[model samples]
Each structure stands twice: as C-alpha cells, then as structure tokens.
Target: MLQYLNPSSAYEALLEFLAAGGNVLVVIMFVAFFMWALIIERIIFWTTAKDGVIKRAKRAWAARTDHKSWYAHAIRDRLISEAKQETERFNGIIRALVAVTPLLGLLGTVTGMVEVFDIMAVTGSSNARLMAGGISKATIPTMAGLVVSLSGLIFINAFERFAKKAEHEVSDELLIE
Candidate 1:
C-alpha cells in the first residue's frame, strides 16, 4: 500500500501527472497561475481599494462649487469615466488569459495524440496499455485548462458587477445638476 502522506510519493505522483500531461500542461499551469493571481488581486482591490476610490471621487465632487453648467457636467462625466476606467483596469487581460488557457490545453491534446501515433508507427502494434498513457496526457491538460477557465469566469463576472455598482454609486454621489 502506498502512503499518500509521504513526501517522496507525493513528489513522484506529481512527476507522473506532469509527464502524462506533456509540455503544454506547463504552459497551462503558467497561465492558470497568473490568471488566479490577477483574480486575487482584483478581489483584494474590490475589498480594499474600491472604497478609497469612491471616497476620493466623493471628496473631489464635494469640493466643486460650480454646478448647473455644461462645463461642470462635463467635468462630472470625466470624473465618473476616470473612476470607471480605474475599476476596469486589467480586466481585459484577465479575460484574454482565461481564453488562452483552453487553447493551450487543446495544443497539449494534439501533441499527446501525435506521440501516441508515433509510438504505434514505430512498434506496429495497437496496444491499449501503451495508448492509455498518451490518452491521459491528451486529456489531463484539457481538464486542467477548463477547470482554470471556469474558476476564473466566476471572479471575472463578479469584478464586472462590482465595477458597475461602484460606478453607479459614485455617480449618485456626484449628483449632477
């Protein structure tokens, strides 16, 4: 019986998983890591930085005495636009990273299939056990990529909603005449 708590065994299992996943899994891992990092940063900003932004915008608006003029309205709009842009920063990049993950996984699948084909061509045998490793390689990265993308998707939507709500709240605070 193998002990799951053993560090050596755990390391060996990780190596096997990576070997079964091929080179593309490495790319998927990198993308997934950065994507999650960005997601966590965004969530932190929402928790901490968001209120500071709103407060600053409110303060700026509160300082303005000139109201009920076209120029003043334009200034208010600009403030709102700036705040919205700040809230939206890095979002497109996050979405792009999420989009790229699955493509990398697909690439892994293609490479793994090619390896399996190469093996069959060399040995001239359709052996199930031999082919199973290649199949695992092809599927593992796809699963990893999909899992990463799906997890990121939730945070992406939440970030957008948070930004939109912040914009609305700031706009209300600005109180256009």
Candidate 2:
C-alpha cells in the first residue's frame, strides 16, 4: 500500500512500535547500531584495505631471494599472522555484541512480566486491557533481539569465511619456493 511506502507513516509506525516495546528496546537499538557500524567498518576494510595488505605481504615475500631457509619460513609465518590480525580486527567485539542482544531481550521480557504482575497486584483482578501493554513489551523485544541476532550472525559468518579464505590465499601466495 502507498501508506506503507510513505516515509512519514513508516517513521510514525516505528516510533509507535518502539514506544510499545518500552525502555529495553532503546538498549537493543544502541547495540544493533554499534554492531552494524562495526560490520560496515569490516566490510569497508575488506573492500578497500584488504588488497593493500595482501599486496604488501606478497611483495615482501617476493623480494626475498632466500625462500627455502628457516628464517624465510619464519618471515612468511609472520606476514600471514599480520594479515590474519588485520582481517580479524573487531570481529570478537562484533560477535560478543551479537551474543548479548538476545540476553538483553530476555531482560526486557523479565521486566515486562514484572510490570504485568505489578499491575495485577495493584488492580487485584485479571485485566486484559491493562496487561496488553506488558505483554507487548515482553514479546516485541524478544522478537527484535532475535531478528538482530540472526541478521548479525549471517554477516559475521560471511566475514569469517572471507577472512579464512583470505588467510589461505595469502599463505598460498607466499609459497616457499
């Protein structure tokens, strides 16, 4: 529908959704933002900086006249290590953030349930209308967390595969001849 496509309507819907999800959604928002930022940084590094690093290592290996010596092998290992470290930067933090999002969502669920219980205690009756807010708060965040985690996992796995492949390629290029 055109209404769904309208940016202002979408914005309003997002705001309303966040409001219903309560305060924990805010934390999830920040975590997702940070995780995506790191993901983007790594993607940029791969696209722009990764080739330069590979070229430098290959050049260093090529400049060596002695490729069969023990020292040459050591130098090759060091180059590969450097390339691995550069490619893997920020990956640990990104993974940790991905792991934490679901936990944050669990926290939101607990807080929301607590809210529901509190309303029940105050009202002394099972009021579906009043409890609806708490139920939404509990469920929305879990869904959001899961969504974020799944998306992040996909990217993290892709980047990791790329890093491993790059490492192997670099090692192959720096062959001991």
Candidate 3:
C-alpha cells in the first residue's frame, strides 16, 4: 500500500512507513532504547568488572588474604563462562532481563487485541482501516521487545565469554603452591 503511493521510491516509502507507524511504533522505540542502554552499560561495566578483579584476587591470594572467595564472587558477578559453574551465577539476571521483556511485549499484544475487539464490537466489521490500529499496536510491541531482548542477550553472552578469560587468568595466577 505504501509502495504504490510512493511509486517505488525507497526513501519515500520509508518516510511513509514512519509517518504511518509513528504513534504505535513509539512504544517499541522506547523499549529498544532502554534495552540498548542496558546493553552498552553492561559492556562498559563488565569490562571494568573483570579487568582487575582476578588480578586483585591473585595478589590477595599470594598475600594470603584468601582471594579465592572474593575472586569467586567477583567472577560469579561477571558471569565468566570459562571459570567453573560458580563463576556463571549472574547468567540468571541476563536470562531474566531478556525473558521478561518479551513477555511484556506479549502483554502489549493482548491489550492491543482487547482494544481491537472493543473497536470491532462497536463497529462490527474487519475493515482494513478500522483494524489496522489494533493490529499495529499488538505486533509492534512484540517486535520491539524481541529486538531489544535478542540484541541484549547476544552482547551479554559475548561479554560473558570475554569475562571468562579474565576470570581464568586471575584464577591461574592466584593458584597456591
């Protein structure tokens, strides 16, 4: 429909797409931004988290401050998969964050559908113009949620791998004689 009106011009079509989608898609955009911020913050945070934790641990270990316990907790918080299962404890938080967003999107779908039904009951037809509002509200949120969830999950997992290397380095350096 948009393409026909824009006469096959991609830029025009895009403009039309955004213009048509402006109101409903705003929710998705907000969620995406939130997820993006979280992902970036975690990236920066975990980089710092793993940087000196284990090295500090090893020094503490060599100093006989019992570094393993503190190192282990730090590693666990970093979710370093290279370490023992103990180091991966924080994976739950990522799983929770990713999992919950999608369900929220699903909730948006349900609420949007309810509104659609209300519209339908009042108007009594499946007219494209009439139904488009509800459908857009329903689908847009889910797509947005999934995009945020999936992108965040991918970056977090990758960070986890990097953190594992740091954890291992600390652990190896700290091992007692």
Candidate 4:
C-alpha cells in the first residue's frame, strides 16, 4: 500500500496517475477548451455581423443609399438579379452556424463515449477507480460542450429575432414611397 501522507510533496501522485493512463483526461479537457474557444469566437463574429447588418439597414433607411438611386444603379449594372441570391447566402450562414453548435456537442459526446469504451475494453478491469477516471473525463467534456453550445444557440436566436424586428421597423418607417 502506497500513501502520499505529505500533501505538500504531491508531485509523485501526478506522475503516477499520468503513468496509469490518465492522459486521456487531459486530452478531453483540451478538446473542451478548444470548442469553448471556438464558441466564443463565433459569438464575437455573430455580434459583429449583426452590428454591421444593422448599420447598413439604418443607413439604407436614412436614405444614405437612396432606394431610387440604388435601384437605378442596379438596373444599369444588371445586379438586381443577384440581390436575392446574396440575401439568401447571408441568411444561410447565420442560420447554419446557429444550428450547427448542438451538432458539435453531440459529436463531442459520441467521441468521448468511444474513448471510454476503448479504455474499458483494454483494461477489462471493472476497477471503479480506473474506470471512473475515463467516464468522468468523458462527461466533463460533454458538460463543457453543452454549456457553450446552449449559450451560443440562445444568443444567436435572440440576435436573429432582434435583428429581424429592427430591420423591419427601420425599413417600414423610413422607406420613401
């Protein structure tokens, strides 16, 4: 029996655990952190994108780019046909990113479960201590994934709704008949 009675000198415990296949937990945490970072970056991007769209809408409504002038230019430039496609493309990116996050979380959960089963099958030891380590890591990453995904999802949906409402109000109020 080995006991680390000295809590101050616990470096050996870390070394021992890592030696006992605990490196998997570190990998799981890394994945979670990476996904969290991506989630934050996407959130920032969505905010910036919303701001840009709102500014454009406000400018259009304020007659900075008068519809008559733009319409005339579009007719001259033959870009009127492409305007619908451009709008669709922009909306698609917003919807796709908002919808894809939960899928990412599901992917993480499945990957983690695969790792857990792999670890279990190799050891063939129902040793609670050893098995629990992998299971815990598997679950921790999942928790992180779900938190990030849900936050981003809610923010995205709210932003979309607000943007749509704002766009409609500005367009309806300021369009020069």
Candidate 5:
C-alpha cells in the first residue's frame, strides 16, 4: 500500500519497464494511448450525442407529411442512414487500431528473436545474461500489444452494440409508414 502511494517509485518503475522493452514498446505505447483516447471519445459520444441525434432524426421524421409516397420513403431511408453513420462513426478505425496492436507485438517478437540469434552467432554458445535482453524485448511487446488490443476490444464491442441498439431505437422512433 505504501509503495502504491509513492509516485516517484511508480514513475521510475514505469520508465524502467519501458526501457527494458525497447523501441517497439514505445510504438505500442503510443498506439495504445491513441486507441484508448478514441475509445473514450466514443463512450462520451454515446452518452451525450446519442439522444440528441436520435431526437433530431425523430423531429425530422415527424415533420414529414407524405409518409407513404416514394420520396417520403427515400427521406426516411436517408434519416436512418444518417443516424447509422453517426452511431458507427470511427468504429472501423477503432477496430483497425485494435487489430494492428497485436501485429505490432508480433513485429517486436521477430526483432527480438533476431537479436537473440545474432548473440548466439557471435558468442558461439548460449549465455543467459547476453540473451536476456532479446528475450525480454521479444516478450514485453507481445504482452503489451495483446493487453492493449484486448482492452480496446471490450470498448469496441460495447460501442458497436450501443450503436446497433441506438440505430434500432432511432428507427423505431421514426415509425415507418
């Protein structure tokens, strides 16, 4: 508990961990940071913008006088399309980011393995201390990438589901005729 309260200790630990992970870890960190930022933004939009958008679409839909005409049907479709676009905004990018994280980790793994093989070729024997750097580099980024991806996955799924449900709600509000 006391250790947790020490900010400097935590900061130092984080720096040390990053240093051990090498440059790939830094890339993963940036990717995770932006991915998380987008996720938070989507969550905020769902909480704040969802209803406003739905209300606006509903209002536009209610104002229509000829619900049965072909033109009116087109307008209704347009409103639904707009609502879906709004709800699904940024989701594709979020998924792409999430997918990229693990691949980055895999890249880190490959680089680390190369380092290990180089050391082996030079030393002509396996040396634990000499090899530890490569091992850590290989494993850390993979762990970091997977952790980042999984964390993002939860939010992405939630956002997708929320958008789907919101779309349905908005469609219901529109009341097709």
Candidate 6:
C-alpha cells in the first residue's frame, strides 16, 4: 500500500483515470477546478474582507447627521447597493460553471457512444472488451459531472444564504434613524 501512496504512482493513477474518462473528463476537471477556486475565494472573502465592507458601510452611515433627509436616504441606498454588489461578485459565473459541468458530462457520453458505434461498424462485433473503453468514457464523465455539480450546488446554496443574510444585516445596521 505504501507503493500505492507514492506521488508518481498517484500521478499515474490520475492520468489513467482521465484517459479512461476521455476528453470530456478533462474539460470537467478544469471546470470543476475553476468553480472550486471561485467558491474558495468567495468563502475567503466572506470570512475576512466581508466584515470590513460592512463596517465601512456602517461607519459611513454613522457619519451623517441628517438621518431623515431625502439625500441621506439616497446615500443609504447607494451604500447598500455597493455592499450588495461586492457581496455578489463572481456568483453568476460560479453558477454558470456549475450548470455547465453536467452538460459537458453529457457531451462526453455522446462522444463515447459515437466512438462505440464506430468501433461496432469497423469490427462488426459487439465485443464487451472492445466496448469497455467507450462505456467507461460515457459513464465516468457523467458521474464526475454529477458529483461536481452536487458539490457546487451545496456551496452555491450556502453562499446564496450567506449573501442574503449579509445584505439583510447590512440593511438592518444602516438605520434611517
């Protein structure tokens, strides 16, 4: 088992897995990497810089003496809007990436099936051994796509809640009074 844990061995295993999954799997891997990177960046922003944004908004709001004026309300709206924009950065891209992974996996399936059909036409036989490669190509990417999408869905939901809560909290803190 120690041999299995070797870095070279692990790298080889990864290459083998990618090869089995075919070209679509490679695309899925890259997309999942990007999606996770964005997710992690968002998490980092929320944990660290997010508070600073809220604090700045609160401080700006607190600085004003006119709490009931129309101009002051406009300023308040602007501050809230800025905060909302900052909070929602990259969310759309992350969501789009998440949504695309499954479709990519489906593309992989189609490509794999086409390969299998070509193999059948050339060989004039339905040999399991010959079709196994295409089958793996079809199935692995589908599984990978679903797995990536589900994981991303979980984070996306959490981030949505976090963003809403942060917006609400900011709104509450920036009182008109």
| Candidate 1 lDDT by residue in tens digits, 1-177 | 467579999888877878879888888888888998898899889978998888888888888898678988988888899899989888998999888888888988898898889789988999988888888888999998888888888888888898999999989999975
Please, what are the lDDT tens digits per residue for candidate 6 over residues 89-129?
98898889889999999999999999899889999999999
Better of 4 and 6 by lDDT: 6
The residue-by-residue lDDT of candidate 2 on 1-177, one tens digit each, is: 679689999999889989999999989999999999999999999889999989999999999999999999999999999999999999999899889999999998998999999999999998999999999999999999999998899989988998998899899999988
**What lDDT does model 1 reach?**
0.87
Q: Taking the tens digit of each residue's C-alpha lDDT, what string does model 5 give over 72-145?
A: 88898899889999999989989999999999999999999899999999999999999999999899999999
Candidate 6, which ten residues in sequence have the lowest lDDT sum? 1-10
lDDT of 3 by residue, 38-90 (tens): 66666666656555555555554455554357665564334333333433444
TM-score, every prediction: 0.92, 0.93, 0.64, 0.49, 0.94, 0.96
Look at candidate 1 and give me any clashing residue pairs: none
lDDT of each: 0.87, 0.93, 0.63, 0.50, 0.91, 0.93
| Best model per TM-score | 6
Instruction: Name model 5 segments beyond 4 Å from true.
Output: none
Ten-residue segment with the worst summed lDDT in candidate 4?
A: 79-88
- The TM-score obtained by model 2 is 0.93
**Quick one: ranking by lDDT, best first?**
2, 6, 5, 1, 3, 4
Poorly placed runs, candidate 6 (over 4 Å): 1-4
Error of 3 at 80 (Å): 11
- Candidates sorted by TM-score, best first: 6, 5, 2, 1, 3, 4
Q: What ranges in model 4 sit over 4 Å off?
A: 1-98
What is the clash count for each candidate, in the order shown? Answer: 0, 0, 0, 0, 0, 0
Clashing pairs in 3: none
Residue 10, candidate 2: C-alpha displacement in angstroms: 3.5
- Cα lDDT, model 4, residue 131: 62
